[model samples]
Target: MSSPVSVFTPEESRAIKQSWKALTADGLLPVGLLLFERFFADVPQVRHMFSGTGIHGDENSPKENFSMETLRENDKFTKHAEGVAAKLSCLVDNLDNTPAVMNICSELGQAHKMYNVKPEYFDRLGGVLLDVLQAAMDVGLDHPTIQAWKKAYEVIAGATKPYL
Candidate 1:
């Protein structure tokens, strides 16, 4: 039966591990930049999620927007991505404990619900992340590698959705 997330085959897991190793050497900044770029481009409303002020009221700046240029220069963006990479690495490193890691993702996602994060953002992020991974790695990442990331994203997103 089809599910929100599927268990990766041993081969797929191996491919994902190799791809992630290359990505680690390259750093997560590029990946982070791509994430914010696609996020802002596809769902501009999410910009307020990371800003200094809330989405409404005079305290909010109407000019506030997400930009690839800005994301590059933004330390917060880089740092946030680094943290994400670290956590994701932790999860991937311990794929043997899939259920535990997934629980962490669900808890984290639920915690963000206080910030008014929507399930759709998780969906959007999953798709854009896959696009970024596939695009950035080019020929180094074959179809099976891409599929591994896709499966991983689905698990993360699916676990997150219930709390949102």
Candidate 2:
């Protein structure tokens, strides 16, 4: 699908992509862990949502079973987080390709909607992500960077909101 009216400027897109790169360069797994840690901790009850069902990225893994319970420290979880990190990486990398990026986000929203991933959860996830990025980055997250991420997220979440 085509992207909605552009919500971000070229400068904003650059900042968002830079922030993503900085956060995940050599610490994708740890950063993902920290983000999910906050997500599960802040919304403890949501952890149960993955008790029986696996997290989003275990479809073709070598592991037979997967759950978020021990995922905070498990390799499977790291792999899982890597999958998501990779997706976000792709999206950020394609920031200039508006149609492709929006389409990907829309598809992702649809996929998550199958599991009842709601719009609010995206916002929560974004906040947790920013917090983790802020803590992880050497210079730390600045205002422009945060705004860039927020705008990028709004595009994604807004696309996903329809399914939610």
Candidate 3:
């Protein structure tokens, strides 16, 4: 089969790969925790969706009141976040292989659909990922590198939404 056409420019792919390397240099776990932490902070309403993940605190407690510490300490949540980070790594590693990227995202979209993940949440998570990248990286969002990440996320979201 012919390789799928990539929407990302070669420069964008390089920027994304470089940023991913820098972002995960410490390890994927911290980046994953930070990503989800920011996601929950920015979109507390979605916290309920992650109930099965064991990241949030007591169900009886107000959703907004759950301690972030609970999420940080939960093994299941940590593993889940790490898995997400790993998927991101896989995507970056396969940037030149557009079909592989689409396949990974399509599978994720299907899986998340089973969990009742909404189409809007994908954008929210993408926004959170960008925020996390900006905050964690020495270079902020204004840089071309972050801009490239933004483009990469758009591609991922676009590819995944069809399966959602």
Best by TM-score: 3
Identify the candidate with maximal lDDT.
3
TM-score of 1: 0.78
Would you list the rank order by TM-score, best first?
Answer: 3, 1, 2
TM-score of every candidate = 0.78, 0.76, 0.89
Clash list (residue pairs), candidate 2: none
Quick one: how many clashes does candidate 2 have? 0
Candidate 1 residue-wise lDDT at 33: 63
Model 2 TM-score? 0.76
**Deviation from native of the Cα of residue 62 in model 1, angstroms:** 3.2
Task: Report each candidate's C-alpha RMSD, comma-separated, in the order given.
Answer: 5.2, 6.4, 2.2
For model 2, the superposed segments whose C-alpha errors exceed 4 Å read 1-7, 52-69, 73-76, 138-142
